[model samples]
Target: MYSWQNNEYEADGVTPKLSEAKRGPADPRLTQSNEDQLNVLLGAVVNYDKVIGDHTFNILAGVNRETIRNDNFSAFRRFFISNDIDYMFAGGDAEKDNGGAAWERARLNYFGRANYNYKGKYIAELLWRVDGSYMFPKDTRYGFFPGAMLGWVVSEEDFWKDNVPFVNYFKIRASYGQMGNDNVYYNDELQEYQYFSTYGFGTYIINDAMVKSLMESRVPNKFITWEVANNYNLGFDFQFMDGKFNAEIDLFKNSRESILWQRNASIPQSTGMSLPAENIGKVDNSGFDVSLGYRETFGELGFNVAINGGYAKNKIIFWDEAPGAPEWQKSTGRAINAGLYYNYAGVFRDQAEIDANTIDYSDITGNLRPGDMKYEDYDGDGKITPNDRVRRDMNNVPTFQGGINFGFNYKNFDLAILFQGATGAEQRVGTDESGAIGNFLLDFYENRWTLDNPSSEYPRITDRSDQYYSNNNTYWLRSSNYLRLKNVELGYNFSTTWLEKTGISSARIFLSGQNLLTWSKNKVLDPESSNALGHYYPQARIINSGIMVSF
Candidate 1:
């Protein structure tokens, strides 16, 4: 397969300036941008199957190649004579600029698989693959991976079928596999050709004259290669009550190594040079998934319900740790990208309570008083300093997630509904700079600490400059667990006899809704949003109706 894409855009800044704009009087500018992209995919597959008596054989093989290229250019000019002539040629060239960029990459892979079964009761399989990546050096570009699986169907045996009359089918399986990852990203940006030293375009003042020049941007690493993961899985599938009930359960564990990262914590900033990235990190993750379903029919009415859930957690087995670093501040043995914050103790209820305390908080705030937030001396030190910060194993990614789907049909009418939820995650929801910008939330303001209320959950009203409000602490962290009504639909199908006279094979009308309702502890913002700081938009709720027909 091959594809190409082209995009062209032209705009006039003066046309919309009849009303006031952000920067005051409009400069009457014209801009144009052109982008082109091409993608190609080449692959082939071969399959063979044979059966003799109680034995069966299946074989497969395939090879694939992919390539991509992109190019873009943009230009803008100011001081246009009029809006009527909104072309680049009509604008002055003194204040004009233009830029362009181009990039290309390719990859190739070869894989194959084989399977064998005995009387459809026992099964075994084996597979292997090799991958070549464009981002790594030629000598270290290819990686080999292999996997195998075995299964048993106890219900298919004659003795088990006679002993267990109610149960219809049962199967158990186990598998192990190794895989390689070539796509790597840093700071949310894709890192390409990381093994090569690169340069960037820049401007510098040489002898009082501005001149364009190329500057070194990154250091080279000839050993950088693919990250690898070894995965193991054991699962079972069963159906009982004459196929009315079914369930599937799986347990999995994975170990990932050679993660690409720069040892910023171990490297000193005094070196004054950008260091290359290395593959020296390892992590382990374990999880379980369960799915249950039931179906029944009462005369013309029928319905089905299913529930699926999964729970996963991970720990960093190895990472770059600064020498002599405190145990509480180390990233090893903790979740990936864990955050550090002051452990919140409570709010100072009164001045007498503050004066009687022995922990010295002068390092954090000079004027400690009532209604202020308090912190714990995590290091057993006498003062509340930077050493007191502790790590919290929580982030925006949920550890437990599940969903429920229900549908039913009665005669010519049908309905469906879906519910979803998540837990074991947290987000910092409160405002960072209060008073100057605004208070964190309306609920926080109503329950704020004061002389009369003396609430323990919230601190007193304070400005942005207050030391108590500026600290990164657990007081701002909130559980992001939430359950939501994801989707619902109702439809009516036309009867076959009625559609026959209309020359139509079938027809139906339906009404649907999405993001209808949500239940969460954090009411100020959507719990699923990573940007709890209010920089992101909340999910939209929609309701619509439509019709479908086939003739």
Candidate 2:
């Protein structure tokens, strides 16, 4: 059994104008203040097990609880003069308080497995688990996920007796199972809100409030169901060449249903709501994996090498949008991380071509003429607008990801090295959204258009007049696809025989380095940062040396 608990608190206040109000210590009247956040969590887990002749059974249960409290205080001072030549003084104070506690998410699981061997030639196993989560409704909170696998050793058969000199070990296996994830946040049963107010002379009144206003439907059918995923896998393992070479290949497909997503629902202005949470989509992911290993020994030196690679593709199988929306609005073919941009046509030639053609440059603001990107008019209306923006021709998935490792051993010393990389992912290079305001230094600002470089990739750095034309261009869009050295570590191990002479069973000293190097075409920042190219805390490169001993 295990148990844990934690608690935290914080307080803050500010009086900006107090120091400036007077030559001496400023008056405490004109000030703003707030105190927030008290949070706590507690949880426990317990396990039970039973053993049979050729099988093992186990059960595990756990519960988690949490609570939070928030409070704020604000005040303003004002002077009021009476008409009777007498001065009257008054003040008001405003305060808001909120607290929430939930006792939820108790989970119970039972697992059982049976293992048997018949003359060590054939092997079989069966396993099953029943899991429950508090986030689901009472009726559907529990489900059984079962899996079974069978393995056969062809070399163990009597037919291989005469071929024993050439045949070693060969096995085939297959499995299928179901898994669940519950990442839902907050309580669904109640509506939560935060209060704000202002203090005035003699009276404090509510100024404003915010609430998680969601449009709920009355067609309640499994509203809080679990997000379920089913997976099927098949593979084969082989060992030959005197056990010096081995390999395995696995193929799998996963189908997920009842996925929880934020569906855009139109709410009446009377309710002042715009969005709601609903289970309205389904997705599928499929992939294949291959691994190979080889080892050989020559005289006093030994060499070993391994390579692993995998590829996966994901697609939205089902999705629905609000009624009365356009077909494009209802379309959900791409993942959330997919990039949306205007297809780039070569720069226009001149103003005569711009005026001779009935092209609408609504999407292209600022100056009009040739030498700018000519976007494909999707609607064929002889004009370019927001409707012309479509999905760019780029990869939405990683083409391939994998790693390779090599090791060498001589006498009591061993050394190892690894190389890893990922390729074929599209990323947006520039800030396309105009309304957002924040940091921009991390963006590529070195190639701004100027008089000296009039034909620069970017537009002229004029005022807001041509802001629209300057906003969208190929100069800002760059291919995010890149291959990088993900990580690397090299280590050497000492012989245990030397440690045994010092009254120790084993001892070793090693040195390692991580994120040591990268090779890619990405120019602005580290290509491996994130899909959304933006400024973030720089990752650090680490190197260390350590020793381990056993007695």
Candidate 3:
């Protein structure tokens, strides 16, 4: 990089350099970062299959071993001799010392699976895995996980074919499985050996020579284990009208245990000592997915439509909460990633309303004035205080999200469109990095309450002048629900017979657009990222046309 800034002296017709050996006006810079990684993998597999009469069976077993090593180096320097020579060695002066690092990790695994079926009516599977990693102690370095699944084709029965002729097929499925996260810090002895007798060097002067000394970097916890998650799934699949229509729905629950927490939050700050991670928390998440589709060919034209939607919610099952905190302040059994917010009772209308109301937010913030916000006092202590602050159920995480897609083909031309949307989430908007605003938002300015516009929906322009609007409140939370046209494409395929003379077997030309439109209650930024801290970049709309040919 190179930049030149006109100095005060240069702008005033004087020499800018302060030293006799000063370099040219342009300040040249160079930076380099390099990474090298090597990996080795070895594995073996054995398979067996057999069929006798109406029964079938299959079995598979495998083992794998992997090793990885990585090295990284970075350096930066300035005051280059020439712009043509961009490397750091060409710099006239060194700005800092170069540094590099090296690290390694390895893992071993053994796995096996067995499957059986009776004709086409029933099926079952059994699986098991044993894994070992250098992140754990030798004695407890390995883990064993097993899982099983069963499925039945209820509509395949002979009786069903005779009783229900119109019904095509239906099947039910259920499965339970367990998995482990090797990267989670759930255990004190967690991760790729960051705690292993690591040492940092110190400098000392001995006999006029620089001497180096070593010291342990951190305390390591000896007892660590893998963070485990268990999952259960149940669902059904069905097809009717001779396979023209189909639908599938699945419900799932995932529970995670032995979650790594860096340190016990309840521990006193004075008692801290290079705290290591510990398995101190649990969480549960549950959700369901549904898909429905219809496909059919009417004469020479064919078309299909599909819609899919899903929702999920999670909660903190167990966590070490404070001893004497109120129920509202605790994290136990509450929604994950909940927001801190105060209740909104609309904007303060006027001084008469402020004097009549018992809610006082002055001590917490500065004096609350008319045209400012109003918050509810949950504790009802005659005045608003920390005790009055409450948690609003609004979370940035969406509980409902889905998409719909449809495509059709007529003759040699085709068209497709897709729409996506989400609801049940809140987006916080308005306000800059500093509590006191810099540039006012257009929305706040348009609806601001004034003496003449006392019925305005938004508080007055004084929002920049008071901390009352700075605190988290309903005034800042906006519904992020929105539906948008995500994608659209139109294409035409040339008849192969027509291109046969040209030596082209196939050809297609298409024009496509993405993020073309959106409908939302929150309009400042795209609802998808409306809750971000600062100004967020809205989704981009891209349009392109291209041709693909094959011979």
Candidate 4:
């Protein structure tokens, strides 16, 4: 059995005090406030066993309990200002201003498995488990997660005894199970206090004929629900050549139902609320995985290699109507996981060419001119509209990704090399094309429009900048594909005999380096690294050396 407890507190008193002449006797402005939190947990486990003939079965059970408390207090008066007016004020301090909340829960789990052997040639085992969490509503919080697998050794079977001479080991196995998450935000069911106020009349005696008015608002969404996910997987494992080579492959599909998402509909303005949490969307993912390993020895030289790779496709399954959404918005389409702006074609060569092209170049913005990028009238309606926009060729997900490693051992020395890379990705580039061509602090300024640089790639500077430099779909996208050398290391392990003489079990030394090299066509500081489009934090290469010892 085990138990634990924790406590925390916070206090604040920095706001300026109100003068007696300007303060109202009935106001509840908090000059000081305090808050505290406390939590405790207890847990225990028990086990049992049973035996019959040559087989045995075991069972295990566990229980856990937790409690939490929160306390808040206003030592003095409190007041909130709204619309430049002290409209709402409640009188309370010390005991009258204090509030507290508490919650408790319990969880239990059970597990069982059995092992048996028949005729020494065949072996089998069975396993199962059930787990529960208390984060859900009392009626829905508990769930059972059970798993089972079966295994068989073909070499032990007489079917392949004479024909297969080199094959030494073989096995076939399978399993299925269900799992759940109760990770919802704490206090999601409480409509807690939020600070806001509105304009109102001052405290003053008035005639019965006089009229006054005030405004009030309430918070929304007193409770929220939890999200759940389900998954299924199947795979196989194989080994041969005296266990020198092995491989495994798996295929899986997962679905996230009732996912928690913020509703996009506008809330009543009188309540000053905009978004609320709801469990209303669904997402699905499917993928395959493969892994291979091999080891061989030739005289005093040894070789080892390993390879692993996987790919997955994701899509949105469902979403209800989004209130106040535009007509262009629709349900059951691939989620907008990523986007890329259209490329900007250079301007028309001249006015005759622009007119001959049947296009209007006047509405173009920011450093644009008659010789900038050419625009295609996608709709063929003789007008430039959103219909003319084109999608980029590359999708956001990396099409191919993997790594390779090689190692060699000779005498008392060793050498190793590793390589990894990723390909087929894209990112948006952030550039400055807004400032005056000659006066702006832009990197492209040094190469602006000029007779010597007349064929410059960037647009020319002019007073009608807004007309040429608009932030359209054409100016904010770029490809982010790249391949990089992730890491490298070389180490030598001393012979065990040498360490044994000194009463030590083992000892060794080595050196290593990371992010040591890269190869790519990306133009930015480092195309391989980006927090997000337009925001990048450069990473530095590193190297180090170290030693290990066991005694």
**Residue runs of model 4 more than 4 Å from their true location after superposition:** 1-35, 49-58, 70-156, 160-167, 182-225, 263-275, 320-336, 340-400, 432-480, 492-511, 525-528, 533-537, 545-551
Tell me, by TM-score, which candidate is best. 1
What C-alpha RMSD separates each model from the true structure?
7.8, 11.1, 6.0, 12.2
Please give each candidate's TM-score: 0.83, 0.67, 0.80, 0.65
Candidate 1 Cα outliers beyond 4 Å, as residue runs: 1-26, 29-32, 75-96, 296-304, 350-354, 366-370, 405-419, 432-440, 450-454, 462-471, 484-519, 534-551
Q: Rank the candidates by TM-score, best first.
A: 1, 3, 2, 4
* Per-residue lDDT value at 488 in model 1: 99
- For model 3, the local distance difference test gives 0.79
The parts of candidate 3 lying over 4 Å away from their true place are: 1-36, 71-100, 185-219, 297-303, 349-357, 409-413, 433-440, 449-457, 460-468, 490-513, 534-537, 542-551
Q: Give the lDDT of residue 536 in candidate 1.
A: 79
Query: For candidate 2, lDDT tens digit of each residue in 122-203?
Result: 6666667676665556777776777776667777787775666454677777777777766544245431110102111222
Positional deviation of residue 368's Cα in model 1 after best superposition, in angstroms: 3.7
Selected candidate, larger TM-score, 2 vs 4:
2
How much is the lDDT of residue 429 in candidate 3?
Answer: 76
* Tens digit of per-residue lDDT, candidate 1, span 277-368: 77888999999999999999999999999999999999999988887778888878988867888998988888888888899988878888
